[model samples]
Each structure stands twice: as structure tokens, then as C-alpha cells.
Target: MRSNAARNALSGCLGFALIVLAGFNAAPARAQDQLKVAIGQINNWENQAPTLGQDAGIFKRHNLVLENV
Candidate 1:
């Protein structure tokens, strides 16, 4: 036979565990797909390099979208 205190403690722990499990199961799914890129420094000659490649359709040829930021 279990004591009343032990039974109450066990029930409290089980309820908390169930609440935690329910929270984990109820996570959001639909997240945005965005890439964060950064460029340190820019050179005058190389500044338009990406633009030249883009104008020449090199990015399209390689299946890439190079956004300058």
C-alpha cells in the first residue's frame, strides 16, 4: 500500500511530465526559408563582378541568385 503523500507526489510529477510532453509535441511547423549572407568589404573593380556574372547569365547557368548586400 502506498502512503497518501507519496501518491500525491507521484501524481503531481506525472501531470508535470505529461504537460512537458504535450508542449514538445505541439511545435510550430511552417517556418520561412531565408538565407542570411554578409559581405565584409567591397572593391571598385570587384564590386560589379557579380553584376557582370549576372548580366552574362552566369548565375542562371549555375542556378544561383546572388543578391548583393
Candidate 2:
């Protein structure tokens, strides 16, 4: 029927739109992307893990730049 054709056309358009939107967000980050970590304002050893790891060059070995905030 004509209504079935119309429905199929709408669904095809919607599916195409979803695929395009997904493609936009599916791109991987470039190598060594700086990642911002939210460490609480607590100035304790537990909260300094990211900073310590960064200083020790642990994240650098894994191609990650940690920015603790």
C-alpha cells in the first residue's frame, strides 16, 4: 500500500540519520590525547594518584597525558 511505502521511506531516512550521527561520535581520539581527570579538592595521597603517575611518566608510556583537575 502507499501508506506502507511512506512508512518505509520514513524509517529509511531515520536510519540513515542515526547512522550519520553515530559516525560523527565514533571517531577515536588521536594518539596521546590529554585526558582531564577530576580529582577531588582533597589534598591527600589518594587524590594525588594521577599527579604521581604523571610525574613518574607512567601515563606517558601508555600514550596518555593526564591532567588532574
> What's the count of clashing pairs in each model shown?
0, 0
Q: lDDT by residue for model 2 over 19-67, one digit each (tens)?
A: 9999999968677878999988757878888988888999998999987
Q: Ten consecutive residues with minimal summed lDDT in candidate 2?
A: 40-49
Give the distance in Å from residue 51's predicted Cα in candidate 1 to where it truly belongs: 40
Candidate 1 per-residue lDDT, tens place, 1-69, comes to 999999999999999999999999996854433333344465566556776776898766655667667
Position 37, candidate 2: lDDT: 95
- Candidate topping lDDT: 2
The TM-score measured for candidate 1 stands at: 0.41
Question: Cα deviation of 67 in candidate 2 (Å)?
Answer: 1.6
Provide the lowest-lDDT 10-residue window in model 1.
Answer: 31-40
